[model samples]
Target: MDTIISIIVPIYNAEKFLASCIDSILSQTFKNFELLLIDDGSQDSSLSICQKYQQNDNRITVFHKNNEGVTAARKYGVEKAKGEYISFVDADDIIPENSLALLYKEHDNADMVIGNFIEVMPHYSKKNKLYSPQVGRFNGIDYISLQLENKLYHAPWGKIIRKNCFNDDIFTTPRDIFRGEDLIMNIKLGLNIKDIKIVNTIVYYYMIRPSSCMQSRKPTLEYEKMFDRFLMLILKRNKLDTKLKKSILSQRIDALTGLLTEKIHLDKNDTFVKMIYSQLKISSFDMRQILLKTCLSHPSIFNILYRVYRKLSSITT
Candidate 1:
């Protein structure tokens, strides 16, 4: 019989948790999947670990290539995958034994199946109590709205996507835009897919490492550019109604605000921050008009107000 699913795990410097991730996939109740371990030029012993697993498991395939990024590794995996359904797993994370089985069971009903995940901290592993519809199918617009609202996560790891939904044009963004690649890619996939299913089961375990890319304090212009382009793309979609466009615009503005305040530290004096501020001022969406104007016109005052807002927000939460 042909492979039912192809699981792609992009490996970088995750030697500490690689074995556990591989073990989780190997122990899955669905035994008819091939595991593709793409070693993205890790400086550590990650490649050796992948090779060791490849030797032990006949279904495991290992590919070694120059360091490109997770996006490139995933593209390579998809190119070589032969399964009817495709799923991704980060090397630092693990999925439940029934994760693949449950997703595959629903494969015939929808183009995509998304499962819930728990955030596992370094010191304490806590199961996240997230509320999601028990089992619901949605169109592309509603699915994207759920994702924008944070009800549905944007990561590729916890979802099972049918191979037919992917085309040659997916994941074409520049490799440097690492922060929100999953969001952009999933948006593209959601746009193409007709039916999407939400499964309330907690299937994947996401490790919240302090040094993860999402938590990094380093400034990168690629993330701002990516978000800008994402918003523009969504706005240009003629099929989207005014209500959906407004919802998407509002969510994207919030994302841009976080980029400016949290990641970039709101340094209006910095050249990159200034460039971002200028771009936000001329954004097509009116939702960000006032905030951008305030920040650009009186940065110091805006900073003070922002600080107060954060304090009040913390208190309310």
Candidate 2:
């Protein structure tokens, strides 16, 4: 009862699992928490369900706003949250009964508490825990490096954060970042976090709904926006050394390569990506950027591959 945790569930057409998600929170072993259900222009009965739950539970607060995607909904909830600590839960996912209690136990010493989650698929479930290198509390530049280098879990769920860790300026320049919003939010949040604890216990049930899958992204103007937005965050952020910068470059290249696996598109984003290659410093390219663990950094090599890949795939229009 000393420091109540605020749990925010951003809802957008998640009516099917909304009830169960709410029930899981209501049945938490730790009761000293506030539940904020933010309905982001959901077309289904998600808002109604939230209203019904709020009618019965005094701690439940329901808010409705225009559909501005998950990041905006999350930002709205954070603005309204009154607790010292905050946690996010996708309305389609569920949290364990002791999840709040587990995260709460570490609040006094850590700026954030991140727990492993089990990915519940149709046939099986897999637990996600920390590896040896990611087993301890991290702070300052180390925290940023771990997060940017993909050393820590990027999802906002399964993590309890000190409310003050959120930097509002990151949200000032609104941009639609596809499905990478969670990682982007976490990247921004990491800058302000002084201490973060990674726990071994399972805390969330990330239900892998079969219908939740979407098509792979093309390197279109939209993709450019997402990448540029992330790059802006990196360049604008202060205190980043050579090591951290390389980590971010590696991560971005990995993502770009992953996208190219599905399909390569000739869009305006390509020009922007070329700039990224120049920034990496070709003179420092050790055996095709093997040092950075990136696929292709040279503009000519990347262009040749992209052109060949495009022609081979026969992608017109």
Candidate 3:
């Protein structure tokens, strides 16, 4: 029987968790699938571990390349993917046994099949199991609106996408924004996506680490620059409506708030905050509308107080 799905696992220095990760996939009841293990120049025993698996199972193909980022590894896997359905799984994460079965059922009618994921800690610590809401079938308008509100913009691993969703032109190109590159990649895929599904069944296990990007110290300019690129992508698409425009803008404000709050040193004469504020005003993001209608409903005084608190906190500590 032909394989229906291609699971792309980008391997790095994750030898500690690699065995269990592959085991979960191997244990899947749905047997018709190919596992592409791209070893991205791991200095540890991860490469050797992958080699052992490839030797044991012909269904698994191991590709070794020089030290490149996760994006590059995924791009390589996508280019070499032969299955009709394509999915991504982090090397350190695990997939539920029924993940492929449920996703395949949903993919029959969906350009993209999105499933819920639970965040697991070390030693399989279970705290706050997370699952996505039933967003229902989304048209183009719903897709844009849900994305800007940060509701539908889930992790890349939870979804099984049609291979044609990423044509040669989209996934092969190199993007400048290396950090938070997932946002732009999702947007690019979503622009062409339709008949999407939002299921509550948790199909993915997301392992949290203290050294992950979300926990590390970063320069605010990286985020600012990335969002700037995101806005440019939005402009070029010309598909978002007025409501969706407002949602995107509101999120941008929230992003700016965090960027400015971080205690990072800037250039002697750099005015990134000022530049971001200027862009916000022209971006036509109506925060007031979002605040009145959503969870961001804070009074003007609260906004002022929060700003003051951040400024003082930044200086005192």
Lowest summed lDDT across 10 adjacent residues in model 2 is found at: 291-300
Residue 64, candidate 3: Cα error in Å is: 0.4
TM-score-superior candidate, 1 or 2: 2
RMSD of each: 5.1, 6.8, 6.4
Off by over 4 Å in 3: 123-126, 172-176, 213-217, 221-226, 237-243, 260-317
Cα lDDT for residue 25, candidate 1: 95
lDDT of 2 at 293: 24
lDDT tens readout by residue for model 1, 130-213: 434436888777776776655567788888888888876678766556566676677678688899888778778887665564
Question: Residue by residue across 140-195, what tens digits does model 3's lDDT show?
Answer: 44665666567765467987888877864444334555455676666667777776
lDDT of candidate 2 over 76-103, digit per residue (tens): 9999999888999999899989999988
**Candidate 3: pairs in clash:** none
Cα-lDDT of candidate 3:
0.71
Clashes of 2: 0
Give the distance in Å from residue 155's predicted Cα in candidate 3 to where it truly belongs.
Answer: 2.1
Assess every candidate by TM-score: 0.78, 0.79, 0.78
Candidate number that wins on TM-score, 1 or 3: 3
